[model samples]
Target: MSFEELPHQADVRVRVRAEDCNVLFAEAARAMFSIMYVTCDEGEIERRVSVTSDDMQSLLIDFLSELLFVSEVDRVVFSSFDVVITGTSLTATARGEPFNPAKHLGGMEVKGVSYSGLTITRDGEGFCSEILFDV
Candidate 1:
């Protein structure tokens, strides 16, 4: 897995493979380390989990919710994520600035993943997918 910040944009680029969660999580953490917008104790976060679902929409919701749950509990906001899907499961890892309630700027609130603008289909090699977040 790998992530890089776009120099001119406010977005991050994420690439990840589905075989392992540890590698993906580490890459996400590294990407978060590069953010200049927030602060927190790097040692506080200690657990990671891989979420699985039958479809892309559900997988996306599950993945983002995991991140949101951590942020709300730890008061951190992640800025980047990489997701990979295999079989009926999804592996996602994320990175973001540490949570600082004192210096806090609001982060995005993601509702559950929606079927709107969501698509899943098979091409020659394998399945291809795209989804739009509610933001």
Candidate 2:
């Protein structure tokens, strides 16, 4: 799994490449957390997330949005993700610890995930996706 931040006017953009759909989802979550400067001490919390959508794009959006909500509500930052995708549904196991402002350096605040410039495609034996985040 790999991802790189792309230039955007005001929001944050990222391009993620992975060996398959599941890896792609996990990497995208990692990339978002990295961008937000979210750091966790250890896996003190584990949450399971399940979402269903009409298509891959919607599924990705819903998955990320759910993570953002979890971060805000639980006051934690996720560091690990185990994801399984089947058709338009996704189930994930997320692991992290409670957010400690004293220990973690905060980065940019992402307002939400955006659909602008979103794309997912097959690349060789892998997959690549581009996502835009509203900051």
The candidate scoring highest on TM-score is: 2
Q: Please provide, for model 1 over 1-135, each residue's C-alpha lDDT reduced to its tens digit, 9 standing for 90 to 100.
A: 244332323233333222244334434343333332333334333435478877655665566557657766765555555556576575555545556656654433444334554444453443433333343
lDDT tens per residue, model 2, 1-135: 399988888888999999999999999999988888655545679999999999999999999999999988988888889999999999999988888787668677778988878999998999999999987
With candidate 2 superimposed using the best TM-score fit, by how many Å does residue 120's alpha carbon deviate from the native?
A: 0.7
Whole-model lDDT, model 1: 0.47
For model 1, the run of ten residues with the poorest summed lDDT: 10-19
Off by over 4 Å in 1: 1-47, 82-84, 106-108, 120-132
Candidate 2 global TM-score? 0.94
Per-residue lDDT for 11 in model 1? 36
Candidate with top lDDT is: 2
After superposition, candidate 2 runs with Cα above 4 Å error: 38-42
Backbone clashes in model 1, listed as residue pairs? 32-96
